[model samples]
Target chain A: MAYELYYWDGIQGRGEFVRLALEEAGAEYIDVARQSGHAMGTGAMLELMKSKHEPHIPFAPPFLKDGDLIVSHVANILFYLGPKLGLAPPDEKLRYVANGLQLTITDLVAEVHDTHHPIATSLYYADQKDEAKARSAAFIKERIPKFLGYFEQVLQQNPGGPTHIVGDKLSHVDLSLFQVIEGLRYAFPKAMKTYMSNYPGLTALRDTVGKRPNIAAYLRSDRRLAFNEDGIFRHYPELDLAP
Target chain B: MAYELYYWDGIQGRGEFVRLALEEAGAEYIDVARQSGHAMGTGAMLELMKSKHEPHIPFAPPFLKDGDLIVSHVANILFYLGPKLGLAPPDEKLRYVANGLQLTITDLVAEVHDTHHPIATSLYYADQKDEAKARSAAFIKERIPKFLGYFEQVLQQNPGGPTHIVGDKLSHVDLSLFQVIEGLRYAFPKAMKTYMSNYPGLTALRDTVGKRPNIAAYLRSDRRLAFNEDGIFRHYPELDLAP
Candidate 1:
């Protein structure tokens, strides 16, 4: 049976991270909420999140239902998928490292989300323009460098070579990092232009992941959602650093 | 060999989540940064984070060194510790559920941290007080209820019972949740005071976790750092909701 993935249909958001892993591994899965004319639509996603019968309840969307088990939180879902999808290291020590990297990526994604919604997730960008401007400034100057630089160093020092983020293999983290670079570029093209040159290894990995047969196919396919103002990595002329 | 935990000497911050598991299990471990008269001190913590030789690099503190393995990120650290400490369930499926809950708690902690520093982590709280006040107001009204209420639903719906977060057993998620409630109360006594009665299940779990023999002893001991302005959960009279 194909694994069922639940997420909003409109944008990639956090769901795209999981989608990248599934695509990378060539794993059979159904993008439940995103499917066209499906019996279980967006409401099904909410039902699963609010489902009381399930042993685990997802606090939000982008959860995975793998036969008997349901997993939530992007990093946590990736943790379960990484091993099965051949995208994570078999060595226990290296697996933990992959997890740490994924969690940190989750952290970066949250900060990126905050740039668009600095004051409150409940509030609109138009309502919090000044706050988003201040947030985007710091995020571009400080957080982006700190996070991307750490990954750059990790890639530089990788004993197995910088082919992947964990050991010598293409782990889930590599896919997630690919997504991070993609999202950041889409959201803050001008701001990232100043910093991208410093992260050659990351840029290289992003390029490689994008060209992977499965990922390349998916990118060209209609399944891949375009980045927009409604998504986590949003572009606003004002939020983007001035040219 | 004792498992070595590296974190700052002061403030519970994120480290306390991992520390809680160690204490609850009465596990043999050394608080590396807290040990006095040692050459390592806090410098060792920074050294590890900056270490070029290690395969895994922690972006910040609260990392664990277990023999040859190194793990970082609070939830990631707990994911490693939970099973070893017997705080998590023996079942594999249940373990992932526990991890999902733990990651959600991590999300809440980030919001709590941002309440005091909405603009930038590089800037002081005073530098961003106006932004913080706006952030905190929304957080108290929205985030606290949303996170706490979701956890309450988890507890109330637990198959094993309401006492624990996963499979009727005390997992690392439970200990982390206890810390969440404790830190929030210490940091937002006024805001929490109004919402406390609404989350009796969570408050009860916190109280129960505190009274656990090992935890009870740890709380009274100096090892458990007091909540302060420097930590993730900080209490400023102005930030807290007024009586």
Candidate 2:
């Protein structure tokens, strides 16, 4: 059976990370919540979540259903799918390293989300614009350098090669990194334009991943959602700082 | 070889989650940063982090070193250690479920940290007091209930029983959940006083875990650090709403 991906429709959000990997491997999967029909769509996704009988209930969306098993969390989903999709290193040890790297990306993504919703996720962005400005300023100045610098260092120091994040091949970490770079560029075009030159390895990897035959095709397809304010990586001009 | 755990000294932050598991299993390990030797201590931890030759550089503290392998991130470390320490499910399928639950706890822990430092980790609590207040209000009202409710439901619905989180036995996720409840009570005593009644399974699990011989001994020993302002859970009266 094809995998069922349950995430909120319209916005890419965290689901984009999973979608990127599936797209890269050309895996057979259904974007369940995106389907417009009875017994499908966002309502179906919520029904699974709110179901009392469901044993392994996910705390939130972006969960993947494979047969009777349900995997939640982007990194967890990627870890489970990586080996099956042939998007992970052959070495078992290196797979853990890939997972650790993906978890770091997860941390960075959470920080990025907080840049706009500094005060409260329940509150509108306008309600906490002042806090968002303060958070975004610090995020641009300190966090971006710290996180992106760490990734750059990892890429530069990888034994396999600078082209890949883990072993000497394309893995899910690279795809997620590619998506992160794309999101950051979209959200902070001004800042990234100045900062992109600092991380040459990351920049080259992002470019290489973008040019991949499947990824290139996916980018042109309607399945790849555009970055918007509703997504995790939102381009609020006021939050974008020139580094 | 004894496992080497590196985390910043002085408080029970993320490291506490790791510590709880080790303590429960009676695993022999060294708290690297807390040691006061010439070649050890926080300086040594920094040296390892700054070492360009180290292939698997951890992004932050709370990383575990065993032999030549290094595991980072609370959830990742627990996932790796769970099987070794016999703190995970015996069945392979249930292990994935255990990991998913642990990841959800990880998300909740990050949110709890942000209740005090909503703006930026670089900024002191005093600097972000106003934003923290706003964030904590929403956290107490919506997030706490949501996260705690999910866990409570999981425990209540567990096929094994309400005592354990994953299978029929104690797991790292249960230990982590115990620590979370303890931290929340310390950080928001007033709010938790009113909200504790809502999560019966969690509350009972916390009590059960605390009563365990090893955990009881660890709590009484100097190894378990007290919760304070320096830790993720801080008791700021202003931020603790009467929920």
**Model 1 pairs in collision:** A87-A171
Write one digit per residue (lDDT tens) for candidate 2, span A129-231: 9999999999999999899999999898898989998899999999999999999999988889989899999999999999999999999999998999999
Models, CA RMSD each: 1.4, 0.9
Rate residue B14 of model 1 by lDDT: 91
- Residue B87, model 2, lDDT: 97
Worst 10 residues of 1 chain A by lDDT: A34-43
Which residue runs does candidate 2 get wrong by more than 4 Å?
A: none
TM-score of the second chain of model 2 compared to its true counterpart: 0.98
Error of 1 at A6 (Å): 0.9
- Candidate 2's residue-wise lDDT over B1-243, tens digit each? 889999999999999999999999999999999999876899999998877998888899889999888889998999899999999999887888888999999899899999999988987889989888989999999998999999999998888899998799999999999999999999888888998898899999999999999999999999999998898888998998888
What is the TM-score of chain A, computed separately for every candidate?
0.96, 0.99
lDDT of 1: 0.89
Q: Write one digit per residue (lDDT tens) for candidate 1, span B1-243.
A: 899999888879999999999998998988988876554679877877898998778888889999978898999999998888898899889889998889899999999999999999999999999989989999998889899989999998888899997887788998899899989898999988999899888888988998999999999998888899999999998889742
Considering the true interface contacts (CA pairs under 8 Å between chains A and B), give the fraction that model 2 also has.
Answer: 0.74
